[model samples]
Target: MGQPGDQFADLRTDYERHLRSERRLSDHTVRAYSGDVESLLAHLESSGISDLSEAGLPELRSWLARQQTAGSARASVQRRAAAVRVFWSWAYETGRVPRDVASGLKSPKKQRRLPATVDQGAAAAMLDGALARAEESGGPVGCRDVAILETLYATGIRVSELCGLDLTDLDADRQVLRVFGKGSKERSVPIGGPAYRAVRRWLDEGRGLLAGPRSGTAIFLGERGGRIDPRVVRRIVHRALGLTEGAPDLGPHGLRHAMATHLLEGGADLRSVQEMLGHSSLATTQIYTHVTTDRLKRAFEQAHPRA
Candidate 1:
């Protein structure tokens, strides 16, 4: 058996390679996994775990207990557990370890933190307010901003997917827009009429005015005519949220959550919402149901006569 230090380093290197080459994880994800594994290694070293076989269920549980005592959030604990599990599984599969000690380790029970989604009325008002402000600004950037916001809420697409969109991804007549989401998965989401109109205005007036000699086929263009960056999209959402009362200072995902929550509350089925959001698991989409239920309970308590 390899020494604990060498084994840890080899396991980390292999896991990172797996994430990059086989799992095709993004740089952000790769970095997170690396950091989580490193933290686990540091913990193991501090605990005097000098051999791979020395780690057992008790040790794993103790590590988790320590993390909880240290005030690590449940979500963070769960993620670290996942990282360890992946590492041990890879080690076992590759014969670097006799067996996987982390196989029986359970993650902390995470509380479901439902996203803060705007109500339908607030969402409409926010979109309308953005459009009105764009009109007042009377510039290409303003028009483009309006279109970006409208498209996000209309299609329920993630910001990264939206920014990666090309001109051909839009089908105005059918009101469908193709979005590539996490894991490089693609789905076609329906665009609302208002968003379609905003896009048309931007295409006819805004994009043309902004496009310079270096312009490409990107639907959203910067002032200098290159593809708009995700940071700019975030800034636009932040500024737009400031215009509305009671609106949470959420980024693009907040708009996505708002769209999903509103859809579920408006009678859309969970499976459909799941497909639209491109969530590989239905459990992820179910959070919106909890949001709806909470809202319903609040309405019932406020309006029903039973006390």
Candidate 2:
């Protein structure tokens, strides 16, 4: 058997390739999986298990225990646990180990915390303020920022999906956007009129100002004319929300939550909401229903005085 360090490095390369080429995971997910697996391998080496075949359920448990001791959040621990499970399962399937020991592994149940959201009025104020700011600045970058926020809220698409958009993805005539989501799954989502107008303004007055050879087919471009990074989008969203009082300090995902909650509260069916949000499962979309449920509970408590 090769030395533990040599074997682990080789295995991780193959594993990451499998994740990208076969599993078709996003770049973010692949990086996360790679980090988690690296941590586990380091734990095995420190525990004196020289081979993956010798690292069994007990070793896995020990690694998780160490994570807890190191003050890892529950969600972080859960994700890491899942990461190892996938890794060990692959190792066993590919004959790198004698058994799929991680198949029996488990992590803590996901906490049922509700995602944060702003009410419709706050959402309007945010977009309105963005528009006013864009107009006042009288520049293309400001115009682009307004369009980015509107598209996120109007369609509830993920930040990555938004960043991936190209000029061809916009269907102004159809009022839809051809979105490529996780695993490159494509879905068509309606574009609200305001969002469409904002995007058109950006394309007409903003995008051309920033586009360059590095921009490629990307609809949005950075200050340097490269594709806009998701981090920059988050920053723009954060700064906008941070300045708007009575609104939670949130980024793109918060706008997504607001979009879903507003749809549910406006009597949109769960299935339609699920499709709009590009959720793979209706169960995932059902969380927004809980937001409406909580509102009902508060109203009932305030109005009912028979007791």
After superposing candidate 2 on the true structure, give the runs of residues whose Cα lies further than 4 Å from its correct spot: 1-4, 303-307
> Please, what are the lDDT tens digits per residue for candidate 2 over residues 1-307?
1224876888999999999999999988999999998888888998887788888888899888888898988899999999999998899889999999998888887787889988888888888898899989999999999999999999999999999999899998998999998888899999889999999999998999998889999998899999999999999999888778789999899999999998888889999988888889888888888899998788888899951
TM match of model 2 to true structure? 0.94
Candidate 2: give its CA RMSD in angstroms. 2.4
* TM-score on alpha carbons, each prediction: 0.88, 0.94
Q: Which ten residues in a row have the lowest lDDT in candidate 2?
A: 1-10
* Runs in model 1 lying further than 4 Å from the true structure: 1-10, 48-54, 212-216
How far in Å is the alpha carbon of 8 misplaced in model 1? Answer: 4.7
- How good is model 1 by TM-score? 0.88
Error of 2 at 166 (Å): 0.3
Q: What's the lDDT for all of these models?
A: 0.84, 0.90
| Model 2 residue 16 distance off true place after TM-score fit, in angstroms | 1.1
Top candidate by lDDT? 2
Candidate 1 lDDT by residue in tens digits, 183-267 = 7788989988999999999999999998977667788988889888899999998888878887878788889998999898889
